[model samples]
Target: MHLPSRRPLLTGTAVTALLLSLSACGGGAAADAKTGEYKLVQNGVITAATQSEQPPFAITDSAGRPTGFAVELMNEAAERLDLKVQYKTTTLQGILAGLSAGQYDIGVAGVGATAERKKSVAFTTPFYWGFTDVLTLKDGKQDALPDFDGKRVGAVSGSVQEDFVHREMGGANLVKFKDQTALITQLLSGGVEAAVLGGASADAYVAKEPVRIAVKLASLQGSAFPMRKNGDPRLLKDIDHQIDEMIDDGTYIRLYKKYFHDPIASDLIKERPKLAEQVMNHPDLAPSRR
Candidate 1:
């Protein structure tokens, strides 16, 4: 999943300028007095930002409409709240920077809700859990993380996988790309000997490309939607409530099955214990026994 950057995507003058521009475009607003709800950037609408190519989480379809697991969940929540969503596609960095600038009300693209990220943005309750995977050419001999040490390894710039490369494979020649599409492109063309991706995303690519997972790292924190820090208490609460309602009604599980075939992540049921019974009842959703 996309993790927070150790460095700010926008700082000082750039942020100030961006904020000023957003304000001029009617960016900020007061809470609604009648409903006690947070006033949206555009009344009755959610301005959401997401990366265009983070598969199974956020991706633009052939028709240019945004559609993916995260996007669908957000859409469902908005529908429940009687609100409309307007999506803008950009790099993951742009999504983070835009939220800080009040240019977007929310960001959804398989974002990991790490403590470092919470310092800048508040997150909705986690909706997905996944591992990290290392990918190499289908016939490549490298089957383990250590085998790639001292070789060129690529990851999306600012993603947790990049941090993994630095911390775990310190000897690697690390290459960073702006997005997953470019990362996979480089991996396929031999620009990098290996690439790290979110587990489900790697699976999506592997299904279609001549690549295979060389390593599967332990799961990380769950993925969630991000909003500006301390912004819109009501909206945050509402989104979380909607997510809970979805789970209770089996809507979340239905959507999970729509985009993923693997059993629901055990960590997810651990986090939301209510899902335990559902998983137990549905054989397909149950984790496989070793």
Candidate 2:
């Protein structure tokens, strides 16, 4: 669909910030992820910025190599666009700092595209969704969380779940953790009745525990490469078109299935992040469906 043009929201200073960022961080790194060249970068090149400690979004491989669902998908997208994907990994908190300083093109971590963030950068259509669920004590099955009006809850910092808490579950006790592990650990240790985190990872952690799905709250819509404001529609169009094609051709599903494990495969995912009223959902174009 159609996203806001941003001519109205962006002030003159913000536009200057965008241009300055692009000119400084625009070029440097290129390599192939599938090939050895993917590991090495030429001296004269630009690199992208990404999250360092975040899981699912990105995490180092068992061999200590950089590899995560988002990272790999980014490499693939770069390959499809015939461009080099270079990245500097940092923390989620500092991602926006790096973006504003022109140290990187876009932040590749799991960032929720809230209206507040759009003032500084632009995001592409969402490719995946972060499944954050409600959790409770092992025996604390009350069906739904709204049932526990006065119970305490927990979530990670800079997470979509936190946003949900501040907006919807304001009456419930809410706490924030630094990461998913800590959030679940706090829940298990009785720090809170339940924790909010990505469903895939949360499911993996809560296995065999008495904790069950309280309710799958809103998802942090997964997004592809983010761009500097008004940076380059040419680049955006190319990436968007490739993603549209990937969704249609089954490549997107293959990569997602290869990295992510879930029961709600294929059809459960429909809603996506929005820039105003425009639904930035992935284009459904599987080859078989075609």
Candidate 3:
């Protein structure tokens, strides 16, 4: 119920030189920027925005230190691009505002890049893809959207999954909550017949108890970072190139496995291979394919 304020980690985030000097070409750092159109500033630093709380993406342990796959990926990207980077953690609602205000150069919150989001900032190719999964009581009468036509559905307010569920199951009554626990409570108390959850977050609530994946909903659309529009597209192009290279060079997979795979987090690791194939063949997602 309590929303924490920003925890500025700008001083702790490490940045490297090569990342700053690299020309924002369509591919990884310009192979030869010595004669490139732009030269990085001597004190170039990218202020990156993230959430104050969230794990596997961005989170701090008991000691209050930042650690996660995103921090590492952006740090390495900074090194490669020759730019010093600072990570600033804030609420999801604040990140975009910060991006627009120029408080941060780019925002990273495992946020999916949708046409809706594109209106605000340019998104690099998706760095990762995930999907929404619906959860209902094991003994519930529903198994899919059609089954819930007249039932009440619980979802977190402002979440993409909520939007998807509202769009996917039009007849179902939607109940909104501000947090994950609250949404689940409404579902368990029979306040709602089902709950639409984001990415691999459904498991976070049902970990200790038993639960089932009612149905695999739409692809999360995929998560991408946001940068202000305009010539930033050039920089976005370079970021896209790095992501492709990361995917091919095993860097992306390594990072994916670290955050999505492993025992501490099997939910992300246990991906539906078929879904991945479907993602590749998806025409709508082709623009930001990596």
**Winning model by TM-score:** 1
The TM-scores, one per candidate, come to 0.85, 0.66, 0.66
Residue-wise C-alpha lDDT for candidate 1, range 229-271, written one tens digit per residue: 7467788878877776777689988999888877666556655
Q: Rank the candidates by TM-score, best first.
A: 1, 2, 3
After the best TM-score superposition of candidate 3, give how far the Cα of residue 60 lies from its true spot, in angstroms: 3.7
Candidate 1 at residue 90, lDDT? 86
lDDT for position 122 in model 2:
77
**Which 10 successive residues of model 2 have the least lDDT summed?**
271-280
Task: State each model's C-alpha RMSD to the native.
Answer: 12.4, 12.0, 12.5
Candidate 3 residue-wise lDDT at 41: 19
lDDT of model 2, residue 119:
80
Give the number of the best model, judged by lDDT: 1
lDDT of 2: 0.57
Q: How well is each residue in 213-244 modelled by candidate 2, as lDDT tens digits? A: 76764354554456667455455555556555
Write one digit per residue (lDDT tens) for candidate 3, span 1-290: 11111222112111111112221222333232221232221236677787644445666658865666666677766666666767777755566677667577777666667788778777766665555777887765455567778888887666677787778889888888765667777888878878887646665545644555676543636667777664345556666555555544556556665666321111121221212222233323221211
TM-score (C-alpha) between model 2 and the true structure: 0.66
